[model samples]
Target: MILTELFREQLAYFKDINYAKEIEFLKGFEASEEEIKEFLEKISLQKD
Candidate 1:
């Protein structure tokens, strides 16, 4: 249980890092909220 909790914490941390990177990349493109949402949706669809 303790290991599971630790893993979840680390996973969340990495997710935050990735999310920040995505936002930074989007900012470079001057993406609006709708554009970002579309981009993320495309990514999620591709992942599946």
Candidate 2:
């Protein structure tokens, strides 16, 4: 779960920014589009 935790932490840090920017930032780390989608889904599930 460490990767998920890290993703969540980064997500929180960028919470105020646009979603597109978030995806760009993650892509800078070489994250694929599918990975970004999955990460967002996981974070949303955690919020529920």
The candidate scoring highest on lDDT is: 2
Q: Of the candidates shown, which would achieve the greatest TM-score relative to the real structure? A: 2
Whole-model alpha-carbon lDDT for candidate 2: 0.60
TM-score, each model? Answer: 0.38, 0.39
Q: Estimate, for each residue in 1-48, the C-alpha lDDT of model 2 and write its tens digit.
A: 877666665653434656555434554578776687677666745731
Worst 10 residues of 1 by lDDT: 11-20
Error of 2 at 30 (Å): 0.8
lDDT of 1: 0.49
The alpha-carbon lDDT assigned to residue 7 of candidate 2 equals 63
List lDDT for all candidates, in order.
Answer: 0.49, 0.60
What is the Cα root-mean-square deviation between model 1 and the actual structure?
A: 8.8
Candidate 1 residue 11 C-alpha distance from true site, Å: 14
In angstroms, how far off is 24's CA in candidate 1?
8.3
User: Which pairs clash (backbone N, Cα, C closer than 3 Å) in model 2?
Assistant: none
State the displacement of the C-alpha of residue 13, model 2, in Å, after optimal TM-score superposition: 20
